[model samples]
Target chain A: MLSEEDRRKGAELLLQAERERKPIPQLSKTFPDIEIEDAYRIQDYWAQARIAAGARVAGHKIGLTSRAMQLASKMTEPDYGRILDDAFYNDGARIPASRFIKPRLEVELAFIMGEDLAGPGVRIYDVLRATEFVVPALEVIDYRTEVPRAITDTIADNAAFGSIVVGGRPVRPFDVDLRWVGATLSQNGIIEETGVSAGIMGHPAAGIAWLVNKLHVVGTGLEKGQIVLAGSFTRPVDITAGDIIQVDYGPLGAIGVSFI
Target chain B: MALDWKTLEAFAEHLENAELERRAITKITDDCPDLSWEEAYAIQDCIRARKVARGVRITGLKMGLTSLAKMTQMGVEDPIHGFITDYGMVPDGGEIAMDALIHPKVEAEVGFVLKRPLSGPGVDIDMVLAATDRIVPAVEVIDSRYRDFRFDLKSVIADNTSAARYVVGSSTTPFAASDLHRLNVVLEKNGSVVAEGVGATVLGHPAASVAMLANMLGRKGEGWEVPAEALILTGGITEAVPVARGDWIDVRYKDFGSVSLHFV
Candidate 1:
């Protein structure tokens, strides 16, 4: 049970880590009593400080949405964090290497909300109805906290969200067969990962449905006009400043970006 | 003459009804030129309460006419503040139904969210910078409810400062990541650059508007310290651009991402 001050300090350390482009010791290591709830509050504090400084929540990102990721993280469900406006990018944008300590790229789909979505009994269909469109996205996963991370630590680190680059074709939720959408992630012209949308809890929207239901417990819900990253389908690929990344979403479209 | 509680409630209802009906009405100040800012704010508060009563959530806050050029243009010494509601947000990359709005215009803005509560008698830029969490690029789609968008400042305040649809960038950068005053924004309409301005145009720095808002809100109460996590739109960086049906508007802020909207 981390105290309020402890949580605030945790956020401050992360902010310092962000500013210095360095990693800090895991919060779980420094504050062993920190619970999942505490981790979220710490993340909240980190985000709110940014908001106070003037960042806006453009959307949310859910992590560990797959069984493999959950198993790897030793968690049963996914974790999430707000996707601040600065963390968003256009396809083909060149990202500087100095922006992160260590960054990995993951292939995912992004859901753009068309209507408000809330919980208690939210489901995939509800998500489908609420989603205006889905586009191919690449999540630049980085950590401000040091790894070998605990679930609490990952949660507090905003699910290791570094930045998100979205491109390719966008389609309405019902316009395509989402379950079978496919992609191949290439780094420097070499195929490093391939994935199917079904790999995300059998449906990409399912995790978003789960997310809204979770947010409901906290007296919040997914607002309209927000973007949601539905979680990675392919395994994360290591990235460096000079690396070029391409994710081909088949008929949906493709995204190309480079780190410099 | 002082407004009675019943009259203020009626005023809120009347303006809100105009909004709901997608109709424009005359500004109240045209009739009652002596409307106090307090009463104007009270009426604005009443409108928000009415919205809450209808299950609409207050999303954030907005400041209007913060730029010296705009203040001088409007003949005002201080900027105005208003509330934003959830229903007023436009989806990123989404199109607006043109008929749903009345003479909408676009204002490219710098939006802020704070890490800590800010209240003030003496809040300054450094204080604002210290408290801010991150900076997000936003475009406010304002549709004034007054006929022909003409109204005195007090009357406009009562109309919630033309609070309407808004779109924010899906990314944010820490305050230290960029120089605020030097930041530049270009407003593009259908691929044409229509306007441009620097961040300093917003009262020398957007943070100054935030500081003024905090100080203004503080003076009203013990301090309605703009709370942490409150998303505040600092104000227009460029002149608000007019839009019509089938028009697309996009604003790009230096070092920040772009937010675009289309009218359909």
Candidate 2:
């Protein structure tokens, strides 16, 4: 556990890293006893600060939901992060490379909820019923901390969420089988990764259900009109300036973004 | 505001040519910025006339974006309708020529063969079921005539909701024989399951999509009714799965048999 003072300091460090687009040393290194709860507290402090500064929380993002992702990250469970309004982009957006440090991209499906969802036992059926549509999206992940970072450090850094680019055809949740939704990611016209949404813990909505239940533990829930990015299915692909990233979601359509 | 018949015809021809050539053009709305919904439907009617003049028979109609998910994804608030031509038919377990489509994607649907003509300003689910003679498994191949499949409602309506080709299953069942809302559908590509959905995926009940279609047509004007013996594809039950040449697509409809097609 971290002292409240230590948590505040960690929040400041993350904020500074984001503001300067520079990576900072891991928080776990400084506070060896920092617990997952402490890390969440630090994240909450940072999120509150941002919200107070006029950045609204648009929705939540669940990360590390897939077993493959969990194994790759050496984490046992998924983590949640806030998606701020300023970090959202549309398809074909040209984003400045300098906005993030050591960014990577992952293809995902975003759910736009039509009704508020809170849960102690929110199931996939509830998510399906509440979802207005599902659209293809690309998550820009930026590790604000230096390497050798622990899970606590990552959790405090808002699960490495930087921004998101959503595009492609939206389909009603029931219109298509969400589990079989496939995404093919390409950079500079070369295919880099391919995967199906079922990788997100058997089904993409399963992750949303997990998130809702997790949030309900803290008396919060997914709100209507919010965009929730279910965890990514494909492995993260490194990105750089001048890179053109496109994700083809088959019948769901396609979305592309360029970094400059 | 209303558009002149000449302008609507020109737009219709532009879209018809794109469809015939299997080429994509920019959305029609880019040229006709102020095109209204009525004008868009007029243009669509004009396209249908041209096809009929060329000996193509209108076999049925289809609903697109009928589900809330589809509407949200397309950024549209309402569902759209389009015509299905006899030339668009691909037999079950048959092949679809890849060269005849721009970029095609297949979606599983429930096909309704009507026995009684149905029109609506107030059509409901019961009325739709009463008029439907049989419900069969179906797969619709949608290929937008707009470059990149990007278009607004007006543009998509003018392009016939990207309707390309479709295959209906051989077996037919009474609409009341099964629970339409709970029927499961699994779509496979190359022997692997690529998509799965339920009959409820099409606006709660597939019949609801047909009802909405009838109502939309009634609202359009007089003398517009889904004719008897017409086959109506109750929109896509699952998201359209992309296909390529040599790919085999199969859709399994629970209790209703299956539909298969190959892209050649």
Candidate 1 Cα RMSD (Å): 24.5
**Residue-by-residue lDDT tens digits, candidate 2, B103-167:** 99999998888899888889999998878788888899999999997798889988888898999
Candidate 2 residue pairs that clash = A170-B73, A171-B69, A172-B69, A172-B70, A175-B238, A176-B239
Model 2: residues >4 Å from true position, as ranges? A1-260, B70-77, B171-178
- C-alpha lDDT (0 to 100) for residue A207 of candidate 1: 90
| Model 1, backbone clash pairs (residues 3+ apart or across chains), number | 31
**DockQ of the two-chain complex in candidate 2:** 0.04
How would you encode candidate 1's per-residue C-alpha lDDT over B1-264 as one tens digit per residue? 399988899999999998888999999898678899999999999999999998998888999868564466577788999999888888778888878888889988888889998998899999998898877889999889999988989998999999888998875444452366656566778875555555665776789889999999998898487778878999887667789999989776655678889999
TM-score of predicted model 1? 0.50
Q: What DockQ, on C-alphas, does every prediction get? A: 0.01, 0.04
